[model samples]
Target chain A: MTKQNTKKLSLAPIPYFWDRDYTHQFYQQVAQSPIDIVYLGEVVCSKRRALSLQDWMTIGHDLQAAGKQVVLSTLSLVEAASELSVMTKICQQGDFMVEANDMSAVQLRTKFESNAFIAGSSLNIYNQRSLDKLKSLGLSRWVLPHEHNQQALHAFDLGNVELELPAWGRLSLAYSARCFTARTHNRSKDQCGFVCDQYPDGLAMKTQEQKDFLVINGIQTQSGTIQNHLEAINDDAVDILRITPQQNNCFEVIALFDQVRKQQLSVTDGQKQLTECTVHPISNGYWHQKAGKDWVA
Target chain B: MELVCPAGNLPSLKVAVKAGADAVYMGLQNATNARHFAGLNFTEKQMTQGIEFAQSRGCKVFLAVNTYPYCHDLPTWQQAVDTAAELKVDALILADMGVMDYACEKHPDLNIHLSVQGSATSAAAVNFFAEQFNIKRAVIPRVLSIKQVAHLVNNSLVPIEVFGFGSLCVMVEGRCLLSSYATGLGPNNHGACSPAEFVEWKNTDSHLETRLNGILIDQVAKDESVGYPVICKGRYQVNDQIGYAIEEPTSLNTLSILAELKAIGVAAVKVEGRQRSPAYVRQVTEVMRAAIDDCLTRPDKYVVKDSWNQTLGDLSEGQQTTLGAYYRNWQ
Candidate 1:
């Protein structure tokens, strides 16, 4: 491993709707991990209220006490006025940084005079001018979209703000108003009994040939294979690496990334261990400018 | 409500204008627009003639420069904006904030509408675009119920336009990456979804298989009808079942809710295809124009005629239409 400094590990907000106690216990464990910053709040569906704003704040404070930065994330799809109100409330929460997943969240945070906020990947900041506009709107950092390649990132001299890449976990591919999980159970979105909670990682979907295809979370569709960038930490194009929380062995995955990022482990050995840490198949194709499901290595 | 129709070529623009469309929307041949097909959209000279022809018939022309511009391709999108302003279209429909900023600063007097690709489903999102870029109107995504649409109409500072008829996009526009996940190209960047160049169809004695970038999207019996391989609409296996796990192939037809949409103060209704033929433009424009006229003339007694439904159904994908997310039950 090449020695690279100023790289940070972040924990993306949980995309699933786990029960309250299980969520708390998961965060409690996260506090002990080597993650430098932890994103908190629900980003998939507004209906998943197992963890209310107050509950998230409590977790944020606890994590902050554990010497990790905490960021409150807003929903990706905003359809109802009620969802906007919740986003407004999140923006009003004092002192914690906010991640604007949608334009609605950006508007609310700007209205609340947020000084430094993160632009979530779903906001789709593609060019330098959009980044400049977002910077004028008080953006401190932004995540690279899933489809952008290394060549695209080199085009922008993002010197004023840091760049974060989604280094690990399944890529969130799409979002819809209809919940596929609810549809899978023959339930309407309005009458969904929170069945998404039953699948901690999301319901797996495969092609007719039994090849893994996608994961159907509540309103979000994610890649079936986990994206592992353990081999690309020395790329030096990004300042931060984000690891999305998974159902099993997430901390173990984080530890491997920590060791690799710190040059305590060889990239080849870390890549091999990462394959064993998660049950799902792993790919790093998006970083290599291929189909997102392709394992470039 | 204004009847905004689509026109992929100059002939289609003329057909739509003659069919009584209030306005027609088209794109350039490049990736500056969403319908960036190989043989679709207009050249600069064709667009000039199209604008003049539509305006002479008292129909407006809106230019769509709606696709997101990446770091290396910003010049092309900026150039498209300059061309739209030079061509004197009635409005510029844009989705990218970077492009919006350039248009707003370079051509402040030009009218701007938020494209559906902007994916601003709520008033907050619309207001952000309006407040930041001075957008005059917004086309909401096809992911909201009527009640939600009404709420947005009531709260938004700009006029709201909703999709009235055309193919359905199940996922929120601009946010979906299923195509890029499979083909490495999507509507946001490439301005094409499941781009045709990457699609392949294989025939067997008993079945037909559709693939995108070598990934199997769907395989069906030979006798069954086949549609374009949209990733969301393809059949897949989930656990113990094999079916359309995400969504079935369908189109959105909101003729039944024309009165309701007008009652809620929707300023315009948009048709969602630009790669269709001139015949399609003529038929759909005439029906929508007649329907809007009837609804405006007598909102209390306006009804969707059976013949109109029959025509639209025949033109729809898989010969079926749904209320989409407009009806609460569809959600």
Candidate 2:
């Protein structure tokens, strides 16, 4: 079922808050890479204040010039009036395509005559009926829910609705406006003091086994293990390979995915390189219907 | 304060009303509402009739159109609002903005209470919905601590409803996809958890076990209850030591904290089971109503006791009750 020629790999926007200089540097390098599309903007708790809209626009333009199509991303956890207002403004922007991570954005996406926004995985899109409905609402493409298998994916009834699968990146598990990281630090949301920016990928939570089980990025706690589909990327069913940007060595991760996309690296070789380079282990159970942290080879 | 009870069907609605529930919330028997179950909810024809039945007994019937509408299905959502407005229920519990906007613009007279599905936890979020959608009340998310709810109510303009009794989620409300992470159907989209059709109970060993969509979910022991396949409340191994990796099987019990809830100025205490039996509705309603009454009568001696901890025996997957976000360190 592996498609000989896969849809090109894309770099999803950073889901955390990094320093402005670091943010500029990440995209500056992304501008020179082989990634197809780059998502820009914060998708976690609203307290990540390092990047402004103008800063996001600048990076979007820079990534576009670097030959990558940049889509502005709305925050997954929009908790306040200001966040909602910000979401409305972000969806209305004409220059860049928008990724509606939250349902509020979906409501605003249909406000205009256009229905071409990217639906984020957080939208809980699972069934063909749901997919068909979203397609009718003008969804250009949908990020498949993490727990889907080939049976579920192929079973999507509508032929027109496009599917984008997460080939790389730690699963964006859950979003909350309440920052667990801030609470862990004994601080309120307003007084969080930009603490989450310290950990680029996310703050890893280990079991008593001291095994890295989960990672907390502000209010959004993701799996500690990244999801790798180097093997599945060969399958024709994959319309988009989303490589989420982690805090460290993400450029190398993107390059490894590029090698797999180009067929230069075998799945075994890719797994070897991935194991060598990635500090954290990789899991694809989400695609296999086992466990979010299970590796199914 | 009002005690909002769940009515999965006509019998349950009547049971809740008879058991002293101030209000009963229900939905049109479809995926249009959050609790879209097989034997649950009312038909549109029955919904109209049920609203009248609740009214006859000095009880209010609120319609829940709380599921998020996808891109193309905005009209159906609009029509849902149109239908609810036409039905003239006391209120329409809403989660999505377009539906809220439709209710605000078309059914201007409708009292719009934000559904917990909306997950408005912050004063700012509550105020935002109040300002933009003109929402009259907010059902706060199951993430805010009691102090947090107090802070939120103090800062916001709208009346706030808190979960005084019901399903205590390990993860924050309106956020976690662990259920979807396991099964595929979840609250944000289909408004279900570990959908029954996807669940399978098999015999892996001596006793029969439960699986959600073919994944080995729970192993039942002799004399132990075989609960529903809820991702957050199942046992799993993190590093070889098997335990409840996601959440334990206990439902939230705030019966002991009802006085604290009343002191916090919460507008209503909501129970969390619409797909439950009429007996379940009556039982929970009687307990919560007693707790609220004790809060009003005794005042000083109104400490809600923890006796009715009723093992709820795997209620998270079916109809559940949680004290969501009212207490600290519930996990």
Candidate 3:
């Protein structure tokens, strides 16, 4: 862990839905890529069907073989009976670290108590007390909520705490039991013919004014604006810079973050390259105390 | 068999009780409850008088102290709960777990109805409240289909109330922070979503552009109707096609399906607006009351009608209302 903190990037597993082969192919290349840390498992909807536990473990092994730290991530909203089993399986790990997306994950991590686990952005970790509580429960690192801009993150940042700083990604805003992407296709969550695989990026949502509001990934709904913060990486103690994978140019996005983190490139250049990866436009609102769509740059 | 109504003001409480509400729920003029606003909600004196009037009319008064208590603001919540008990209100509708814990511990005998803000969609979640805090009933989420309700009600021990009409949330209740992210005011903690403070309307050439928190939520053509600038009510684009990608500006008018919900063993039908006008309250309550009566009188020949609009007057227009997940899944 100490050796790899030197300007490396992690390719976050595709938070949206993807086919098994696409996921396999994605991780195969990621294992071979410059990404130092690779967080695997489904973080959005439980019913995405892109990867099961066996497939995830296989991919995790492949990534491990490629010389990367594999962290298994849990679902953002753990509601139904089937979801509980998935959450339990993710926490019942020995080798890989786990990211706690919901309170269920937090509870499991609390039982492990001293064993370090990653806290997710969705956990509503606002003040230092909550951060201290997570730390008391063995919270190792955290992916900042997309809405937490540099300012709020800095305010909420436990200055000397052990949690890792999630440097960037498309903010995972909300989650629901209803498969929104499936609902868009007039399909039920149970009977839907796995349509989320068709759009690897996400299904874009527009307002009545025809403006982009959000994107439906699977059970998860994310801000349409890619809440990236590679620009905020200026002479700080950011341990891990997490970037969620898109359909294309994930490797390039990771490379850009690495460059910015190392001070090898200007923040402007790092963010400019990020805009081309095809997730959505870049936003830094959570840092600005403004709307998630409102970017400072 | 109770009708839980919202009273955003003293007058609304009067209207609600006069219009046949078995229970009327109100919050303080602060964020202690989910309907926090500047001019809306009751003052302490207004609440006391409102409670007195409701009790006189065989109507119960439920005080809402539903917002999650911030770590430092527990005293404000504790005082709000204490005040509700001191007023000797019929019941207290609560959402926050800590507040429920406090209320149950302090005033064990005060009736506590779980607020919909808790988002108790499952029986287990409801049972968690019921068994833990002695919660008598729960106001359910608006997302459940009637069939789902039938199944849920058939299996549950606690009585459930469904939101039969009014504001519909695009996502699940009690969890959304989109409003606070967009505006400083959020429904979860702030009790107002797309708060009026962030709303701006402009007549732009051929459309009424309704903006909330500077986000262009809707741009209605001269002929179209524009509803509130809620995130879910906004129109959006998918695959280059744009319209109301989430929900239309239509109100949740499930009065047509009141009998269907009643058949599912729903103990109460909730009307969604407390912030609406007295006339609005009177009209909605009268129509809902009439609908329920109609359900009992002509069970087989009952027909849901659109005359509730006469009560709302011009508050609504050209809404294509689907049963919205209460029958089929939302399209």
Candidate 4:
């Protein structure tokens, strides 16, 4: 494998519903971190109005001024026309790079900007041909889908676009029209009382055997375990490591990944530090092409 | 609106055609299609015969080459497309953008319909696919409400088709990774979710347990009726409650809202089971065809007949039918 010091660290957009103050405070800590890129915006639910576009832009400016590249991420599921309009506005901002999570976002970004955009992992890019097709539409970098295994990556001709992989945090598993968080509280989606804020890390779902299975965050369902690939940070395929924001010490998590990627700390020590910060167990089975919830290591 | 039915094999295709289906959709006996189950789908000779039989009876046959292919296996999907085009099927239902690009450039004359696995929920997404590949129609995912379906139909550049009667997928198609999280196989990568090989059934003294790859999916008393062990439909615990957290084991039956769907200008109604038997196809196709014809003929006097309901219920998963996301309350 080719070797270089090109590995960078990226902060994935917040997938949970954090209150305004908590959101601000989280970014305040992120600004002082050694992360290379900061992706800001609400990518999960449209009802999550804790941070508006202007609010995210203000934070983006702050992160940019702090020597971090800011990328605004669009919603993964674009259902309403209003959401499409918001996406259009974000794509046309021209101030920051936009991560196209859905195809509508990609179309809007391609229509507005000539420069390549970052294709988010939600785009379902499974093959080289799909990658080549996206490249024609001006894809600058592509995030591998969380389900993609090491063998799948080896076979894919990533071409010239940079590859980003999720290194830590809950793996987003499924999305539906029904708000699971609302359903959990026996409320309709239209009348949902923004109860997702009650569980900043998301409501845990367990199997019948009481095994922690999944987490419900509004309409998005995520893995119950944190997916950490810190040991694979030096893998040549990954150009960037994405650390998703969580409720706890995400700054420390980012620092741990940074140290491990820079080879300042051994992977074993980094994994131990990561385990201490996570609320649940850590899984790396996805990297080994096994069930995503399994810990192959 | 036209009625689109699924036919897993030649017998199913013949059954659907005999039952007055407007079109019968099937796939090759390979992993290129989404319903890549054992002892199902059609061979090349059977596909040619099925096409001839359907065309002779003024019915169309669509080939579903809908599964996403990775780099190493893309040639298999491309070969399926070439075979479908050479067999002179009515249309190719595709989901992958790469495969769509291939079909668009390789066989310009072949018709293309966006598969439900494409997950185009909004007008902008549909228009993007239409503009890029010139898809003739796009199937809407089962996640939209009836009002949303109407809005999409009014705004879509191409005609839209929605699921009418079949197994309901609670999660949006093309986006779910729950199966892969459990069994290491999923719709996008493996074309099947909660594959049969991973399923295990055990009977204890008091209850019957269903597991998927050693993960407990559901457990029911011995006297209770059992449903298919699909991962999403299984009972699970969320908060203090334990039940069908994701979705219940019910089939999506939109028969009661046929008039509303027809009024919204929905182009076609798609059935979901390609892994089902020929008997299931015949019964569902006949009932849906009768219902659609009756609704179209007398919209003012249309009523969902009890007989039709019984027929569908007898074949439905868990013996229950719901409007699914067509009604907001079901959401």
Candidate 5:
């Protein structure tokens, strides 16, 4: 059911590898936006060295100074020992609340006895008992997996845990050890030359019919069509609406969402404005229990 | 190291046991298991008979109720756990956290093996499951190189099991949603990927087209053979070129690395594909069994025979094989 007013807006970390100056400018815009929480980190390939952990911490501090709650997100796939070590440092940094993207991150947080952390969508918590199990291990909130539907959310008996939903940006569909961005260039992942920086958003993939199919950013694959859930911002089941960072017009998208959530704009008008913000097609099919590429309306 | 094999039906189970599989893993005829195919998997009666047949042959039986259950479907998964415990299978392979919690509480004595669908790629992730659910063994995803695999084996709190042969999952198992993005059903939630009902193959004047839920996945010349329409294996266009942008159709064959896996202290080597025929299971089990036995017998003199490699390659998808991510070069 649609509640008249939504609670909060969160900015998901930049899933791409952008230039340092470009990333700083993006955050400068985010600092002045109406985002309530800001997640900052290199959640995708750890090889993308455009930003270091200290760099993210600086951005976090700046966003915090701007009166936005900040979260440090760990990597979604931890395959290398070096990657695991990085995750351990994030879990133990003890500066900001951590978002555990993988079970390895969750284990380290529980072992270090961090008071409470956010469960990233990739944690694979599909049921209430699973959430409860993590709750016992110090979980305060969780971002629902993008594939989950409204019916699945209703089934979860979330006692006091807050729920966050992805409301905008390209959906991260899958991750692999093999980097597609490198493979597209016929280069191995180790010798990738950090070419992912060329596509600040992500490299688009199309079907044989030239239909938009997917986006490749190093090891992560995302939906070619951006997901716009502006209509669902008023969902009472959601405590926060997540807006992933894009290469352009992100704040305008955030402002439109902010207006919609505050009941300052109609859903129809908000969606119409959202279409002008990105060249990609928009989808809300996952929220309607259909294929993720479809738009219900 | 142990040689674990897949069995989709009672006949396949018997074939695997007779072919020298140390243990045979089978799934129930429901969405509780990953291979939720139309005509694949075991009914309750078939499961009881299969378990009895395997046990009588001195081969252990593992019940795989490995799919994640939605909260509304908790009772169905809980019932599966109860049935597995009552039947007294040697161990249960599970992926869902809630199902694992239920099995741990209801049948504390039952052994649990973390399924690859659990997506535990590191020591910390496996240890977390071991501490929380008391899982005796964990299967790592196929995304790790041999060096990384050795590192995890060295650090994991419990014994680790790695896939020996299978249709490789290019993406991490449990975290992937590409199939659902196209067809609205996936391995994690629906126990299937590129489900058969959504697949359609069309023959044209010049080429054969493969589609999943009406989206073109791959089109091959009339002379070229087309395998299943898994999204990762399909060709797509990126930039100016059209090719296998994700992955080519190939099966993972670790026959060359059998000795290395044993040397790394891996507990078992699992052969994937529960949807294969009994003939495929028989040949794969025989080859894997002999390979493991040879490796254990004389680690210094172990060499993969050309005939064994030829036999496995013939049975692979697309009649091709790859080292997959086990070798760093593949990554």
Candidate 6:
């Protein structure tokens, strides 16, 4: 086992909406976890008002007190003036690092502070040149988009900026203006009624053959299969492993990853534990440069 | 407002120009451009000919070098930009920041239009491109409503271009990875969505099944009309109901809202079909040109003619046309 103390585990901000109390409870549990970093705030639809800025700040303070790095994430798609306003406020918070999910957020961050920020996965950084360009714009760390293969990562000289890879959870495939969860219930986006809360992880979508395909979480669509790269935790390219928060066993998954990273458990044992905890099939094909749905194991 | 039409080849470019397109956008026959399909787009000689033909008719030619380049392939994208500049194309439509930076530094005088794939929905995002790369125009993503478009146009430092017609992408461009998830090819990395090679058509006893890289996208009866198995447009079992869960397979037709678009100070209207035939380009370009002309001539008298609607409807995907995200109801 590689004794690398640099490997850190981060909790990705919840992409779906849970009740405010549930979110608070989740973070309270996270505050006691072995996770190194916690990303707070919403990255999906703005309609999800489970937590306000003050709520997130309070949570951030708690995580900070718990000896964890807190990075506030901005929205993935900034279409409205209201969303842009929120993004600007988030970027100018100045207390914590901001994850610029959209270009607007990146622009706003660069405008407010020359200090480094994390470029979220939605900001398409396909190559080393693009990465270098973003680095020039004050990007300190970046999450690799789930679509990029490991071969692509190996080819790039990522420089000083830390590389964070999604180590667990469903891949956020796409986001749209229309709330798909609303559409599923034959309701308009304006009248979505926060139905995404019903499926805390996300609403599962299947093919005609009853094969699990996608999960619709309001406007965001994710893979039905949870991406588990616990076995590949020792990759030198990765500095941080991001585990997305889910409704169930999210903390256990984080603990398993932490144990694996610390050499307390074998990769196979970690995978077995993760499989036992997750309801969906596990996949690592995106890391293997194959179809995302394919499970190499 | 100007009408920007797409040209997959030299013939399509000529048809666009002759059919009244103010500008025709195309790409090189490589992954540097978004429409990097087999036997589509242009060669160097073909691009030169396309520019000459468009210029002869007092129309403009824009080269689309819009795809993101990996570190190993950065030189190819830079070369494409350099070649397009050398060819004296009217403009270069680009998406990636690195490529935009290269274009700005290497070819300072070349006009750069931010591609729709850049996903610049907000004015701040548009201004960022304009301020950094001196982008002259920006193609807005198809995710914004007309009200949102108006807000952006009001605040934008650069001129705004909107998708007036063609197939609608339910997700914001540059952000979508659904294609990549399903077929290992996407607009950002591979420059192709639902790549032709991954597409398979199977005819069962009762239905015609379309699959992309072995994931069943849609299955339809023999008599039912079928569209391409673009993952977003596919039917799926959502909430125990089977239908187009994401978006129905329909082409965007903003002809009805031409007057409103003009009033909102939109600099140009873009037609989004490069993989389409010259005939498709000609019909769409002609109808849009006529509609824009009529709308400009008399805004009060402007109305989407049934004939124009029928012409576009004939060429629409799935034999259906929609206002898409431009209409708030569609969202």
Give Cα distance to truth, residue B89, candidate 3, Å: 4.0
Go through the candidates in order and give the C-alpha RMSD of each one to the true structure.
Answer: 1.2, 7.0, 4.7, 1.5, 1.3, 1.2
The candidate scoring highest on lDDT is 5
Tell me how many clashing residue pairs each candidate has: 0, 14, 12, 0, 0, 0
lDDT of 5 by residue, B252-281 (tens): 999999999999999999999899999999
Candidate 2 vs candidate 6: which has greater TM-score? Answer: 6
Better of 4 and 5 by TM-score: 5
Model 2's DockQ?
0.15
Write the residue-wise lDDT of candidate 2 on A1-297 in tens digits. Answer: 246455777788787777889888878888888788888887776656788888899888877776788888887765455676778888888889889886668767777766588988776564444555567677887877676666567656546655677887888877653565665565655677888777776776554335566666777778778888777776666677888887677788888878876778877888888878888878887667565677877
Stretches of candidate 6 off by over 4 Å are A1-3
* Local lDDT at B202 for model 1: 93
Writing each residue's lDDT as its tens digit, candidate 4 over A113-188 gives 4557999988978788888888988998998888888888888777688889998889988888888888888887
Give Cα distance to truth, residue A66, candidate 3, Å: 5.9
In model 5, what are the clashing residue pairs, if there are any? none
Give lDDT tens digits, candidate 3, residues B1-331.
Answer: 6788889998999999999998898999888888877789988999899999999999999998887655566678889999999999988988776677778889999999988777665554566567667998988766666776776677566999888667666566766767766674577557888888899988988888888777787777878767777877676667666665555666676766777777778998888888888887887788888888888788787786656644443444234444556755552
Local distance difference test values of all predictions, in order: 0.91, 0.73, 0.72, 0.89, 0.91, 0.89
Interface RMSD of each: 0.8, 6.9, 4.3, 1.1, 0.7, 1.0
Candidate with the larger DockQ of 5 and 6: 5
- Per-residue lDDT of A1-297 in model 5, one digit per residue for the tens? 346464799999899998999899889988998999999999999998888899999999999999999999999999999999888888998889999999999899997856588999888888889989999999999998988898889888888999999999899999899999999988999999998988888998999999998999999999988998877676778888999998788888889998988778898899988998788999988888999999888
Off by over 4 Å in 1: A1-3
The sequence of per-residue lDDT tens digits that candidate 2 reaches over residues B24-53 is 999886667888888888878988888888
Say which candidate scores most in DockQ. 5
lDDT of 6 by residue, B1-331 (tens): 9999999998899889999999999998888888889999999999888898899889999999898887788899999999989999999999999899999999999999999899898999999899989999999999899999999999999999999999889998888888888877788878899999999998989999999999899999987867788999999997788988998889999999999999999999999999999999999999999999999999999988999999999999877999988888777
- TM-score for chain B of all predictions: 0.99, 0.92, 0.93, 0.98, 0.99, 0.98
Write down the worst ten-residue block by lDDT for model 5 chain A.
Answer: A1-10
What is candidate 3's CA lDDT for residue B288?
Answer: 81
